[model samples]
Target: MEFDMVAAALRQDAADVATYARVLTVTLADVLPPGSVTVEYERSLGDRLKGREGHPSRIVVRLGERTLSLTGGHRPVAEVHHEVRGVVLSRDQVSLDVWVQALARELVAQAEADARAAEALRRLVTGA
Candidate 1:
């Protein structure tokens, strides 16, 4: 599914589009097959010493020949990088809304063909 499709679904299902998109990104990362999505954490020395798992700072999703990379902090802005095959297509600073929407769209597209992904999305949207 494209971002537009995901947006339409969210408009119909979610009370808050931005929050749902962010949650969907995390859900996709957790549920997708290993090696399909990679998450990076920004752990401080104190966190490492305490054996605490830091929050995700970066997520990279690879679908077929395209890759979408999102890097974010505590702010509502994120750095997004997209590549097709091995060529860089776009790299820009986008709002958190834009970032999560892109990620959700990729997950929706994956769900269209993958049962596991579809199940995850269904469960998420229905809260079942």
Candidate 2:
């Protein structure tokens, strides 16, 4: 998707307009190494807020934190270890820069790692 569209999504008001799931379901599956890095689950810190009562239990779209979960994908790489990877979205406390940066960084890193792993796996299989 275009960056403008993403920025627009961030501008939305989860408390009033965006859905509980919509805010948290902005997915970029292929951003990481081919199935190398995965979203295991998401945890919400929005509970500490007040007006968010009207929102769903998850009213944010924070990647790697709320909207996405990390599973055992990048681990197999054994060459690169990335922990901070996801967008950060909330009802009123949203950080588009942080989220975008995190996602981009992870996406690039994972893409690179996946490329490297592909060669590594190929070598292993071919015994070359």
Candidate 3:
């Protein structure tokens, strides 16, 4: 079958981005086919306030046929590692510049895979 996959990231507050990343990861997995999407998150510590410190966060997403990953980090200092995956025709990404770049690359890879799948399907259908 021919498939099309698109991935994108939206700049938003650290907390909101984290929340949405997690929620979307689960939702996408449930809705999409098996093993098609991935989500990740990275969280870091923030500045010290009255001896209390905060953190910065980022998010990432991957949407494809065989692999999907998303990562996000949380606010003052940021550390990223968390990741998840699912299946769907939709897209996913991390709002951070670095993660977004990586996700973009993965999207291209997925597109290639989708194209190959399409070509194979066509060949099968035509018996050629």
Taking all chains together, each candidate's TM-score versus the true structure is 0.65, 0.27, 0.30
Q: How accurate is candidate 1 locally (lDDT)?
A: 0.61
lDDT of 3 by residue, 5-87 (tens): 22232222123554545433442233333444433333234334334323213333334332323333233222223344433
Give the candidate number with the greatest TM-score: 1
Question: What ranking emerges by TM-score with the best candidate at the front?
Answer: 1, 3, 2
Q: Write the per-residue lDDT of candidate 2 for residues 1-128, one digit (tens) a residue.
A: 23333434433422222231333243333332343332222334664354333322322223233332212222211112223554333322224344433434434344455665334323322435
lDDT of 1 by residue, 1-128 (tens): 34565555554553333343355466554446668666677788999999986666666666665565555544534556667777878777776566557656766777877877777777666656
- Collision pairs in model 1: 1-109
Off by over 4 Å in 1: 1-26, 29-31
Worst 10 residues of 3 by lDDT: 4-13
Provide the overall lDDT of each model, using Cα atoms, as 2-decimal numbers: 0.61, 0.33, 0.37
Cα displacement (angstroms), candidate 3, residue 46, comes to 27
- Model 2 superposed RMSD (Cα): 15.0
lDDT of 3: 0.37
Ranking by lDDT: 1, 3, 2
